[model samples]
Target: MNLFAEIRALVIQNLEAMQSEGVLPDGLDLGNVTVEPPRDAAHGDMATNAAMVLAKPAGLKPRDIADALAGRLVADDRIVSADVAGPGFLNLRLAPVVWQGVVGDVLAAGTGFGRSDMGQGRKVNVEYVSANPTGPLHVGHTRGAVFGDALASLLDFAGHKVTREYYINDGGAQVDVLARSVYLRYLEAHGQEVAFPDGTYPGDYLIDVGQALKDKVGDTYVGQDEDVWLEDIRNFSTDAMMDLIRSDLKSLGVEMDVFYSEKSLYGTGLIEAAIEDLKSKGLIYEGVLEPPKGKKPEDWEPREQTLFRSTEHGDDVDRPVMKSDGAWTYFAPDIAYHYDKVQRGFDALIDVFGADHGGYVKRMKAAVSALSGGTVPLDIKLCQLVKLYKNGEPFKMSKRAGTFVTLRDVVDQVGPDVTRFVMLTRKNDASLDFDFDKAVEQSRENPVFYVQYAHARVNSVLRKAADAGIDTNATPDLALLDHPAELALAGKLAEWPRLVETAARSNEPHRVAFYLYELAGDFHGLWNKGNDETTLRFIQEDDHAGSVAKIALARAVAIVIAAGLGILGVTPADEMR
Candidate 1:
């Protein structure tokens, strides 16, 4: 149960009571009222700005409203004391039993303790790692993949019908380059020496695709001209690259519900249909764009083109849909793709893009806005670069990937768990430094290790209790968990449900990682505290009931950590090696 929400409801109930009792005026909008954890735990268990927000509205003094509200709040059995702090902030400290209830709640709910229904089953499409199907995914795409996959999981936990999607950039020039590169490899497989030109991919990963093509066709297209092989090879190479990408993602524990082909939008009349939808709304026009800022008029050759009135829907300027040569511009297919998403009847849309695509955000949003007639909202999250370091120096690039580190390169080095956790240790928009040495380090400084150790420690406690013949399955007397350290951990556990809704509302899954770290800190803090205080030790030598209750509290922490880690797509460690 969400104690914060329950307390907020109590505060609202008391405020309405005060209004009826003439302590405050009627009809004050209580929407601004909020009950949250106090900034300082020393202040109280929860703090509310109800008095401060309603004071001016009710034509009453802040302290006067707070005093009246405090008296009414203490009448509830949960709240033991309500003290007014600076101005009109009311800090309420709940009874020990209230915090103790949190442990029992966590044990009962298990990993589902923090799952929320905030999204209310809304259909959401989260499109991420839509990298060009040219080669295996790189480090940049790795961050996007983890962020998007974790976000999809977080949304699902928060009660959204999330669709994990990967939009294949197979219809672009990049795929053509890949086809040519594979063609060169195909010639090499046919015993012909070939040199990769500057425009084609030179990665050794393509050597196998070339050899596979040779195996399939038996050099049928080895000496053929581009006209005969380009189309067939382009399709073949895209399928191969996508297969490699899928394998890379699967290795990292990321699986997409849909792998949408960009080629489907081309030749299927979808682009024209999407543009026509815009045209019907008067958002399409043929016009010459103004020369870009800082460009001299003589240096700029303005071309009249078919444009989408993106400026009407929050973009900086109108965008061209088709070029002067009458070929669809690069953005035309993206518009069609998003239009198709809207037509699929998703209540909301989320796109996880790499940081370089920051400029595309406004225009893509504008397209969805125009296509959905402002009905479906689009949220674009841009994941910044991930810098790899090892042994205090920059990590070397993958030879297989040619010039950059591939996702498999990172996952193979640290395994998927560490890779996933370390990737999310930073915010999506913030640049992350993934140090190979630091990621696997067994220290409090490493969040992944710290959080995992907490889970393993709990498991260790359970195992020790089991060996000692302690009946942990018996109903835990939560009331015995009255120590300050025990209560502090329960207090942290109580924040999970609230934190889940907050993170899902903002579309940030890194917050889950952050919260798990804090929870682990609280747990480890209590575990350490047991060293100096014999009464605080979880496994009481002579008291089975006491040990069971404390172990229950420790088990509760593991439950929430596993739940939080589950949302992050990282498996919890039963024992850290």
Candidate 2:
């Protein structure tokens, strides 16, 4: 159970009682009232702004309301004391039994302890890693993939029905370029000399595709004109490139529920249907966009084009949907894609894009808004660049990927768990530095290792208790867990449910990583404190009941850590090597 929520219910109930007693007016808006952990742990277990928030609204003095509320709150045995802080904010110290019950709650709930129904079963579509099926995914896509996958899992944990999607950019001229590049490789497989001009891909990874094509059709398309092979090879190369991309994602433990193709939206009425929907709303019109702010009138060419009145929905300016030649602009397909998502009946949409696509956020959101008539909310998260370093120097490898580091390159050096956890250690909008040396180090400096070590330590404790014939599964005398360290660790455990709600609400899975680190730190601190204080030791040889009580707390730490790590798609280590 959420202790904070229960206490807040207590506060609200008391406020209602005060209304009946004429201490406060009836029908006061209590929406602004909030109960949370105090800023300073020493202040108390929880703090509420009930008095401060209601004082001005009720036309009453702050201290008078706080005094009345405090006197009523302490009537419950769970609330040991209630003291008014600055400006009539109420700080509350709950009885030790309250913190002790948190351990029991965790042990009882296991990994499901912190799961929330904040989403209320709403259908949320999270689209990420929409990389073009041109080549292997790079480090930039790695961050997006990890962030998106973790977010999807986080939303599911928060009780939303989530769909993980990938939009394939296979409908562009880039695929034609890939076909030509593969043709050159095909010629090479046929023992012919070939030169990869600037526009063609030159990676050796394509060598196998070329050889495979040679095997599929022996000497059929060799020495042919562009028309004979372009169509067939374009389709072939796209399929093969998509296969490579899928492998890249699989290497990092990512799997998409859908692989939507941009080309599929074409050769069909989908784009026209999406535009017609907007047209019916009077949002589509023929217009010319103004020139850029710095451009001279003489140098700028203003062409009349088919445009979408994006500003009506929230874009900075109107956007062109079609060129003067009646060809669809790049935006037409994206609008159709989101329209497709809306047609699928998702209650919300999320797009995880790279930082470079920040400019497109407004337009995409505008398109979705108009398409769904503001019924479906769209959120676009941009992942920033990742800079790799090692031993105080920049580390750049994967010559096959040319100038960039492929996702495979990173995963090959450090396994998928390290790669996934490290990618999430930073906020999606912030640049991240991935140091090879630091990531694999076993010390506490490595967050992945630090968090994993905590889980491992719990396992170690459980094993020791089992060998000593201590029945950890038995109901323990949790009331014996009154030591300050024990209480502090329990306090951290209680924050897990609250944290899950906050992180899910903010759409920030990185917060989970941060919370796990702090929780691990708290557990490790308590473990270390046992070195000096005999009473603080978890395994009390002479008192099996006391030992079981402490082990319950330790087990609860492992449970929460495992749950947090599960959202991040990292395995919790039973024992670290």
Candidate 3:
């Protein structure tokens, strides 16, 4: 299954054998030892730094340990040769059957072949796309939604119990602005025409909310003062906007396990309890912070306020939790929200925030650390902006969101699969350019298209094999799959499990997209290679056993591709349109 792991275990076993036989000293730390794919495939199948890692600690030369280790590794049936390269790296060439066996294992395991247990069932909460319930979700939230959903799926694939959460920003002044905007729309839905003033949402999306409000209550609150309708409309507009947001996310194949409201934290003693918990730890105090770095002294004046001792936990400076006006700052609700998450007993927490919120990461982490006493770790991943391109020009804004492209616009344009795949083509912290022209192209230049085409080609081969009456259900003569090209394809298949473990451990789901692309490239390369060599074709008229062997390898590639796409929330393509 995992040949690399199997070989590494062999290396460790032989090292222990060496120690017990008095060939080496006792109790050396083997934690740093690692076996991975060689940098250049032409050199070997796998390379380990066992010698380099142990040389200094064991008081021995790297070459000496490497040579001794190589001697023992060659005796294993799976290892064809083990040679020391560079100062101490052990380069290994595995037996042909070792790679062949990967195909059999994949067929037996099906699409679950590469699923890993690396997470050990740890509880992780992933909060993402917590955009304020003001209007529709935009392109930036789309990137966060795709990235966070894929990351949660990746963690789940690796054996973590993940909860997808959305924190509603309902307690902020923005919601009040939304209510004011919707009230104007309500007036517009009546006989009177209303103009949207500044500080109010003017997008066309709110017109329907206004119309719906008018439908529910006909002109009762139309002529009322702010006090008569602000609170009621605030609740009404937020619910409507959240319904719109939920529809947008569902369009992109994203769903949240929880939708926590900031309004619930207000006047409910939750914020007080959290701050009190921090106060008990001496983390809260009333103090005046010095002028922030790089700010003109006159630009920022000293003001006495309630501050959190974030500096004690790793923040650059103590952050104020309450303003001089005796009102809680925006950071207070966030701290309380995270405190609630910690009390829920999660092993870890991950927040996917926009890149503009990068400044908030350290302080948020500090709050979680102080509140949880460092028992729970909080990781905030900042997603950079997304730029849309069409016809060699920047795309226009959505009239619905006003000055931004909505998530519904993207999903409607490219469908969820292209939207999700293209969103993850870049790293979360890096800016992404979603080009309408490039995303749907049926060429290798487009990664999603290329990967999907590979899956489709594999399906084509299966259909062809079945039509030829080649007994597609027969067991493959895996040993017959010894051609260099065939074995290379299998070698790529063997990396799937390891890739899943590494990508999940790093919390980078983009790695899954990248790996799927590379696997597709390998599969495509083998498919093209079959054109010139009749023997390399997956379906052979003369040799049914040989055809079965090659079909096995092709099917394995498709299985891995589908599994990888599943983690990305992308549907595998059986045919390209």
Q: Model 1, range 445-523, lDDT digits (tens) per residue?
A: 9999999999999999999999999998899999999988889899999999999998999999999999999999999
Candidate 2 lDDT tens digits, 1-577? 7788889999999999999999899989998899998999999999999999999989998988999999999999999999999889999998999999999999999999999888999999999999988888999999999999999999999999999999999888999999999999999999999998998899887898999999999889999999999999999999998999999999899999999999999989999999999999999999889887785678669899999999999999999999999999999999999999999999999999999999999999999999999999999999999999988788866788766889999999989999999999999999999999999999989999999999999999999999999999999889999998899899999998888888888899999999999999999999999999878888998899999999999999999999999999999999999
Using lDDT as the measure, name the better of candidate 1 and candidate 3.
1
In angstroms, give how far residue 314 of model 3 lies from its true place.
Answer: 1.3
In candidate 3, what residue range of length 10 has the lowest lDDT sum? 291-300
Q: Which RMSD does model 1 reach against the true structure?
A: 1.2
- Please estimate how well model 2 matches the true structure, expressed as its whole-model Cα lDDT: 0.94
lDDT of each: 0.94, 0.94, 0.92
- Candidate 2: regions farther than 4 A off: 297-299
**Among all windows of ten consecutive residues in candidate 1, which has the lowest summed lDDT?**
291-300
- RMSD to the true structure for each prediction, in A, is 1.2, 1.3, 1.2
Ranking by lDDT: 2, 1, 3
- The CA root-mean-square deviation of candidate 2, after full C-alpha superposition on the true structure, stands at 1.3
Q: Candidate 2 at residue 576, lDDT? A: 93
